[model samples]
Structures are given as structure tokens and as C-alpha cells.
Target: MGTDNRKNLRLEVFGILKEAVSILCKNINFLIFTIIVSFPLLSFMVYYETFLFKTMVETWDLLSPRDYSNYNRPLPYQLITENMNRDFAYKLIQLGLLYLVPLHLLELFTMLLTIDLASKIYSSEDRPLTFKEMIEKPIYKAKLSSTFITSVYVLFLSTCTLLGLIWLVINYSIMLRNFIYNVLFTVIYGAAFVALLMKYLEWSAQWNVSVVISILEKVKGVEALVLSAYLCRGSEKRGRLLMLVFFAWGVCLRLPCLVLGCYEGGFGMVLQNVFNSLGNVIKWIACMVYFYDCKTRILEKKVDEEVGNVESS
Candidate 1:
């Protein structure tokens, strides 16, 4: 029974992908428009990521000690200092404001537009909206506000998760001098890390669906998040699987650029941006489909329960 349930969950994830593809094929014109519109934004995204990677490498080279004389020092000593150079800090701040912030807003807009379009295509009731119409909707303001709030919350949680992992690593290194204790600590830390990661993934799924809820419904901010959590009650596995699939897709798309510094202009770079944009379009579409499926499932289950109660009475 458990095995069958697991198989069904896996199939549902792929089913979402299949439906997304079907929607794309059925609306080739829409797909072309999305690609053309998104191409510039995605190209910027690729460049931003590659630039960010190179910047980090350069920053590390600047901060790293030139001498290996203290190589035997503890892990905490090897970590980057809190007191970063003022010039470098200012440059990073400038980078964030000048490039990162605008790019992030653009990405958010792209995702929301894709979600709205995909939802329309999936429903088959309303005609697909034009870009201007999409932005001009009254709900667009609410979506933008809510999605921004959600993004901030997600960023906070991500920062906390990273700090927690870093703390664990530092503590583990501090205890490495004691063999048995280190072994026990390692086991406990490993378990804790896995648990932390799983919890984060679950929250990530809720956060993602909340953005959709914010767009499709009248809810915003915490209310949307609460609704998402409620709707995802029995479908956590499906949500997590969907999240993992897209997360994996994004990593695969960006990993090569990071490794090879694909930011340099070439045919390969253009192809990467094109494919990345398409993937982004499909990802939001799949998420929209998944959201509708979860909603339908919850409603049907409630209807079934009410009918059973009526029959019993």
C-alpha cells in the first residue's frame, strides 16, 4: 500500500509536467509570445548568475589568507570574518541595488505573468490575457505586494537555514579533537541537518503555492500562506516532489554556466538563455496546474465526507 502510494505520488508529479506541456502545445502563439517577452529577462538572469559566481570567487580570493602557515588552525579561524573590507562591502551593496534588485523584480513579474497565463490556458474559459491587460488588472497590485512579502519571508528563512548549517559545521569542527564524541555528534548533526532540509522544502512548497493563491484569489501575505498550508494538508508529498523537480531543473540549467563561466558571448550562451526562459515558463505553468489539482482534491474530499455523513444520517 505504501509502495503504491509512493508510485502514485511520483506519477502525479510527471502528470503535472505532461499537462503543462499540453497547454504549451495547444497555445503555440502564447508560447512564442512568452518566449520572446521572457528572452531578455532570462538572458539577464543568466548573466547575473554568472557574474555573481565570478564576484564570489574574486571576493574569496581577496579575503583568503595568502599564507598557509595557519592551515592547521580551527575551521572557525578559516571562515570569512564579519568585518569585511569597507570598500568590498560597499561594492557588494552597490551590486545588489544596481543589478540584483531590479533583476529580482523583473523575475517576479515574469513568474506572475506566466502563472496568470498558464492558469487561463489550463481553465479554457477566459481568453488568454495580453501583457498589458495582465499588469493592469486590479488584482495585479495585490499579487505584486503579496509576492514581494512572500519573497522577503522566504529570503529570511533561507538566511536562517544557511546560518544554522554553518553553526553546525563550526560546532562539529570544534569537537573533532574528541573521536567518540565527534562520531556521536556527527550522527546527531547529520540527522538534524536532514530534518532541517526537509522542513525547509515543505515550507518552500507552501511559499510557492501561496504566490499562486495570492494571484488567483483575493488573499495576500500571511493569509495566502495560511490558505496554501491548509490546501496542501494531504498533498505534501506531491508539492514537495513538484518543488524538487523544478529546483533540480533550475540547478541543471545554471550549473554549466557557473562551471564554465558561460557568460562570454557565444551561440552556446544564447541557447542557454533561450532554454532557461522556456524552462521558467513551463515551471510556473506546472505549478499552476499542481495548485488546481490540489484545490480540486480538497474540495472533492470535503464533498465526499458531507455525502457520507448525509447518507449515514
Candidate 2:
């Protein structure tokens, strides 16, 4: 009986994967828009992060003159002095205050527009929208707000789970109390950490479509999460499998860009970042396709039951 259940689960997962890919492939143009809309923003983020770190390091060097012989010392040692780099500190504060608002707006726009585009593409009742039409159409500002809140919800849950697991491990494991690191302890602890991380990922899969719900149903925040979980209740396995595949794909495709960026700067990093963003777009498109399928199935099931009740009456 267990074997049969496992086989059925495998079959369902495969079917879901196939259908999701099919839907994405059928509307490749939507996927292109997803890439185009976000690629510039992603590239800017990559460039900006690299620039920020380099600027800080340069400022640190200028503020605290260090001999080449002391290169082996840790970088944080520069800030150990009673009088730290006031100029660098001021610059950091200025940078943060300057970029916070604009950055938040850009991020919010990206999430809302990409999700809105995905929903429109996957929605059968709606026709494909042009770029201008999408912008000119009154944006559902509430959906964007909800998406931000839902993200906070997930982040808080994940952080709590991680902290709780860490606390439990420390309390339960005598080896950890003294920070002992024998081979046996290392293996056991490593395995436990991996298991916890896997569990967190699986739990997070439940909320994968919350943004989809927020946009389509105009439900935001906790309500979107509740609706998303309800819709995905029976399809948990499929959601996990989908998330696993997407994670694997990201590691395979986007990981290289980060590795490459270390050695190759300037145009090379920008080009690689663009490709990585495109890969992310493809992933989101597939995610949207899966969300559409799950939603359609739920709606159809509800309609069928309602029709049966009416017929009996």
C-alpha cells in the first residue's frame, strides 16, 4: 500500500511538472516580458552591491592606513579602534538614507508588475496586454502592499524556525555547549542542519503562490497566505517538487554568474547578470503556469460540486 501511494505521488508530480512547462512554453512571449521588465533592475543591483563593497573597502583603507605586512589580519580589524572612520561612517549613512526610498519603490514595482504580467498571461479570460496597457492600467496598489506583507510573514516564519532549531540543538547537544568538533559531532550536526534547512524549504513551498493569489483575488497580506495554503493543500507534493526543480535550475544557471563576476568585471559581469535575470524570469513564468493550473483545478472542482447540487434540486 505504501509503495502504491509513493508511485501515485511520483506520477502526480511528473504530471504537474509537464503541464507547467507546457503552459510556459505556449506563452513564451509572456516569459520574455518578465525578463525584459526585471533584467535592468537585477543588473543594477548586482553592479551596485559590488560597487558599494569596493567603495567601503577603499574608504576603510584611506581612513586607517595599514601596512602590507598586516594584510593577513581580518578586515574587521580596521574598525577595532576607538575612533573609527567617521567619513566612511557618514558616507554609509548618507548612502542608506539616499537609496532606501527609491530602492523600495523599484522593488515594489518589480514584484507587482512581474506578478501582474504573469497572472494576465496565465489567465484564460484575459487577453495578452501590451507594455503600455499594463502600465496605463490602474495598478492594484493593494496587491503590491500585500505581497510585501506576505514576504515579511514568510521571512519571519523562516527566521523563527531557524532560530528555534538552533536553540534546540544547542540545548540538547552537550558537544555544542563547549563548541566541541569531533568527527562524530561534526557529521551529526551537519546532517541535522541540512535536515532543518530542507524542512524549512518544504514549509516555504506552501506560500509560493501567495503573490499569485494576492494579485488575482485582490487579497493581500495574511489573507493571501491563508487562501494560498487552502488552494495548495492537496498539491503540497507538487509544490515541493516544483520548488526543488526551480532551486536546482537557479543553482545551475545563476550560480555561474556570481562565480564569473569575481574574475570578470565591467561588461562581462553586466552581461552575465542579464542572463541570470533571464533565467529567473523563466523560473517565475513556470511558477505562474503551475499556479494557474492549481487554481483552475480548484475552481473547476467547486463548480462541479455546485452544479451537481443544483441538478439534484
Candidate 3:
């Protein structure tokens, strides 16, 4: 019975992807328009991310000049001078303000537009709104405000998660130097890591759905988040799976640029941006499909319970 249930869950995840693809194919014109609209923004994002990655690498190298021949030996922590640390911190702050903030805002704007179009497409609404029409809607401002709040909330949690992971790494490294405490540290760290990861996934699922809710409904900010959490109650597993699939897909698409440094220039760079934009489009559509699926499940379950109550009475 458990095996059957797991299989069914897997099928539902695939169903969401299949439905997203179906919608895209049926609306090729819409897809083309989305790609054209998204390409410039996404390309800038790709370039910005690559530039950020290279900057960090250069900064690290400058701080800790290492011999490539002695790759096996880890760099001594003591070698990093206080001045280097301060410089690194300053550089991070500069990058965050000038680059990261704008990047995130652009990403949110792209997602807002994509979700608006995707929801309409999925529902087969009469004459899907163009970019101008979408922004003109009175509710559009509410959606923007809600998404901004959501972004800030998510960013705060992300920073906390990063700090937690850093703490774990520092403690783990300290424990590694003391053989006697290895086993205890390993057990405790393993449990903490798993707990943190599960919580992150749970919140991520809620965050994605909440974005959809903010755009489609009148609800904004905390209310949308609360509704998302409620709707995802019985379908948490499916939500996690959907998140993982897209996360993996995105990583796979961008991994080559990171590994090969192909994003430097020319045709390779153009191809990367194009593919990333398309992936972004599909990912939002899949999330919209998943949102509807979860909503339908919740509604059906409620109807079933109401009928059962009637029968009992």
C-alpha cells in the first residue's frame, strides 16, 4: 500500500510537468512573446551571476594566494589576515547593493509577468492580457506589493539558513581537529542538517505557491502565505517534488557555464541565456499548474468530508 502511494505521488509530479508542456504547445504564440520579453532580462541576469561568481573567485584568490601544485593541503585559516577579511566583507556589501538587489528585483518582475500570463493560459481565460494590460490592472499593484513583501521574507529566511549552514561548517571543522569528538559531532550535525534542509524545502514550497496566490487572487502578503500553507497541507510531498525537479533542471542548465566558463562571450553565452529564459518560462507555468492541482485536491477533499457528514446525519 505504501509503495502504491509513493508511485501515485511520483505520477502526480510528472502530471504537472506534462500539463505545463501541453499548455505551452497549445499557445506557441504566447510562448514566443514570453521568450522575446524575457530574453533581455534573463540574459542580463545570466551575465550578472557569472560576473558575481568570477568576482568572488578572484577575491578569494587575492586573499589567499595558494599554490596549485599543493592542492591536497587545505589553506590554513590563520593565513587569512584581518585586513583581508574586512576587504572581503566590504566587497560583498558593495556587490549586494549594486548587483544583487537589482538582480532580485528584476527576477521578481519577470516572475510576476510570467505567472500572470501562465495563470490565464492554464485557465483558458478569454483573450490573455498583454504586458501592458497586465500592469494596468488595479490588482496588479496589490500583487506587486505582496510579492515584494514575500521577497523580503524569503530573503531573510535565506540569510538565516546560510548563517546556520556556516555555523555547522565551522563547528564541524573544529570537531574534525579533535578525534575524540568526531562521532558525537557527526551524529548531531547530521540531525541538524537534515532538519534544516527539510524546513527549507517546506518553506520554499509555500513561497512558490504564495507567489501564485498573490497574483491570481485579491489576497496579499501574509494572507497569501497562510492560504498557500493551508492549501499545501495534504500535498506537501508533491510540492517538494515539484520544487526539486525545477531546482535540478535550473542547476543542470547553468552548471556548464560555471564549470566551463562558457558564459564569457560569443555564441556560447547567447545560447545559455536563451535556454535559461525558456527554462524560466516553463518553470513558472509548472508552478501555476501545481497550484491549481493542489487547489483542486483541497476542494475535492472538503466536498468529500461534507458529503460524509451529510450521510452520517
Q: What is the per-residue lDDT of model 2 for residues 1-313, given as tens digits with 9 covering 90 to 100?
A: 3322322232355555554454345555655655566865785666565555455455435535355354332223343343356776676676564345444455456666766765555454435556566557667567666777776676567668767675445433434433433446656766777677676656666665776666566777788788778777777777777677766765565456555544236665566556556555555545555566666668767999999999999
1 versus 2: better lDDT goes to: 1
The lDDT of each candidate is 0.68, 0.59, 0.68
| Candidate 3 segments exceeding 4 Å error | 1-11, 56-87, 98-100, 125-139, 162-191, 263-270
lDDT of 3 by residue, 1-313 (tens): 3322322343388888877786677666667667766866877766676666676565546545345354333333533453266767676676677554876777777778777776766665445545555445453577788777876666666668766865665455444544353768766876787677667766777787887887777467778788989988978888877777776776787778767876566676667767767776777777777777777778778999999999999
TM-score comparison, 1 vs 2, better candidate: 1
* Model 1 bad stretches (over 4 Å): 1-11, 59-69, 76-78, 82-84, 94-100, 125-155, 158-193, 263-270
Per-residue error for 193 in candidate 2, Å, reads 2.8
lDDT of 1: 0.68
Task: State each model's C-alpha RMSD to the native.
Answer: 5.7, 8.6, 5.9
- Evaluated at residue 101, the lDDT of candidate 1 is 71
- Lowest summed lDDT across 10 adjacent residues in model 3 is found at 1-10
In the range 121-182, model 1's lDDT, one tens digit per residue, is 66654355455664454535766777777666655666587568756655565445444646
> What are the clash counts of all predictions, listed in order?
0, 0, 0
| Model 1: worst 10 consecutive residues (lDDT sum) | 1-10
Each candidate's TM vs. the true structure? 0.77, 0.62, 0.77
